[model samples]
Each structure stands twice: as structure tokens, then as C-alpha cells.
Target: MVEAALFDLGGVIVVGPWEGFATYERENGLPEGLIRRINSTDSDTNAWARMERGEIGLEEFAAAFEGEALALGYRVDGMAVLNGLSGELRPEVAEAVRRCSERLKTGLLTNNYSPMASSERSAELAEVMGWFDVVVESSVLGVRKPDPAFYTMACEALDVAPSACVFLDDLGVNLKPARAMGMTTIKVVDPDEALAELEAVVGFSLRG
Candidate 1:
């Protein structure tokens, strides 16, 4: 039985990187897949990986990422790429979070920048985040998703076994480790579909 529901903040809770990437591509006339390539690269040495871990600052990340993209035959604005990390909250997802909180332990397991760096988008998102019983931020923890320890820490913080928690994330790569550790994983592609899947897993109605 699932006692806790773990969620990813960016793609799972809000419109994120990909949406920003689309906007950047359109504005710059650059080839698509620039941000994708940057994020999908080797996690250990990639600029995005470093930034998300709080190992590097935003200014350094912008320059480092821009340099990498330049070698790939296009130039992208680093700040523009960074801007895609935050997005508007989905109302339905917010409602689902409150619903989940009523019956289960909910956690926010997000690979994000440091709290000092990421500004609150609005009162809504800040409040939605507050609904989670535990928030495991990668920047604060010095670890990013796909790292096994990150998953372990989230479970520990929530005080639930991996098997008793359902983890939701937009990235398949991030979900792999959780699945390996005996947690049920949900890939959140569309808001409605993902929430429906969550309802089925935890045997509760999140639609309210």
C-alpha cells in the first residue's frame, strides 16, 4: 500500500524546461534540441547537472552551457535557457496535491536551483509547495535525480519505505533509480492522465 506520494516540481507540477526551450527556439531561430542536448548529456560533467546540484552559480552555468551549444553549431542565451526552469502551476495538479495531503504523505522531490536563486513565481506555487509534508530539493541536498542517494534521502525524509511511496516525475531517467529501489513510479506526461494514474495507485480520489 502506498502511504506517501512523491512528486517532481518542475515538469510534474508546472510547465517547465521544455516549454521554455520552445520559446527560446522560436525567439532565437536556433536549432531545436539545444536545451535537450544540454540536459540529456552526461550528468556528472554537464553544466546543467552541476548547476542543479548547486555546485555552480547561474552566471557560470550560462557561460558554460553557451560554450557547449556553440560547439554544436548554434548559440543560445544561457539566461533564456535558465528562465525555462520555472513555470505556471496547473490548477488541477494543485487541487490534487491538496487532496493527496488529506489522505497520504506527500513529498516534493525536485531537482532545482537553490532557494536563494529561484524566485517564487507567484503566491499560488509557493502555497502549493507548502502542501507537501516534505520537500527534498536537490540544490539543498547537493544531489540531483538519477542519483540513487537522492531517492533514498527523499524516502528517509518522508519516513516511508520506498515500496510504500509512489514517485512521479517527468523524466524517465530520474524514475529509473526509484523503480530500482522498489518504489512505484509514474511518468507524468499530461496533467490529467498522470493524476488519474496516481488516483489508481493510492486508491483515492484526487479529482476533488
Candidate 2:
């Protein structure tokens, strides 16, 4: 039986500000999908992973990510892509989290940068993250999603077995590790559909 639910912060819990890159793509005359190109780089050695693991600073990430984008024939201001991450909470997902908390343990598992990047954003996000019983932030833990150990750490933090948890993330790559660990997984492309899937798995209404 599933005793816990795990959520990914940026894309799953809140809408990521993808418009910033849409605007950038329009103005720069670069073809669409530049930001994704930067993000889809080699995960282990990419600046994104390094920054989230607290091994590199934001400026370094910007520079390195830009270089990677250039190599892909897509030029973008990497800082803009980074800034685009601050998106509003998806109300449907938030309500589902509350309901899930009532029926099962909830956790916030995010691959994010250090608090030093933005004290204000960090402080504000912490208030909303209070819904979760356990929050495994990559910056704090120096580990990130897609790493088996990161998933294990989250399960340990929530004091639950991986087999008893259901995890959700927008990216399939992130969900793969959880599913491999025997945790049921959901890829959250559409909030309503994802919640509906969660409802099916947990046998409860998470809609509010």
C-alpha cells in the first residue's frame, strides 16, 4: 500500500516560468526550444546539476549553460532561463497536496540551487513548502533527482519505505529512479490529469 506521496517542487508543485524563454526565443531570432536544449544537456556534468548540488555558483552556471546552448546552435541569456523558474503555485496541485497529506505522508523533493541565490525567494518558498512533512532540497543535501541515493534520502527523511510511496515529477528522467526503486510514479505534464492519476492510484479524491 502507498503510505506516502512525493512531489517535485519547480514543475510539479508550481508552474515554471517558461514564458521568459518564449520571449527570449522570439526576440533573439533563435529557434524555439533553446532553454530545453540547455536543460537537456548531459545531466551529470551540466552546470544545472553542479549548481543544484551546490558545487558551483549561479554566475558559473550562467556562463557554463550559455556555452552549452551555444554549442547546440542556440544562443540565450542563461540568467533569463534561470530567472524563469520562479513561477506561481498551481492551485490544483496545492489542493491535491493538502488532501494527500490527510491520507498519506507528503514530501517535497526538489533539485534546486542554494538559498544564497535568492534569500527572498527561498524564504517565501519555505512558507508554501510547509505543507510537506519532509522536504528534501538538493542544495541543502548536496544531491539531486535522478540519483538513486537522492530518492533513498527522501524516503529515509520521511521514514517511509520506497515501495510504499508514490512520486510525481514533470520530467520523466526524474521519475525513472523512483519507479526503479519500486515507488509508483506520475509524470505531471497536466496538473488535472496528473491529479486524476494520483487519485486512481491512492483511491481517494485529491481535488478540492
Number of colliding residue pairs in each model: 0, 0
Q: Estimate each model's TM-score.
A: 0.95, 0.90
Worst 10 residues of 2 by lDDT: 115-124
Candidate number of the best TM-score: 1
Pull out the clashing pairs in model 1: none
Tens-digit per-residue lDDT, 36-70, candidate 2? 66777787889888899999988998999888887
Candidate 1 lDDT over 107-151, as tens digits, reads 988887776236645888878877899888878889989899998
Compared with the true structure, model 1 gives a TM-score of 0.95
Question: What is candidate 2's CA lDDT for residue 96?
Answer: 87
Q: For model 2, what is the C-alpha lDDT against the true structure?
A: 0.83
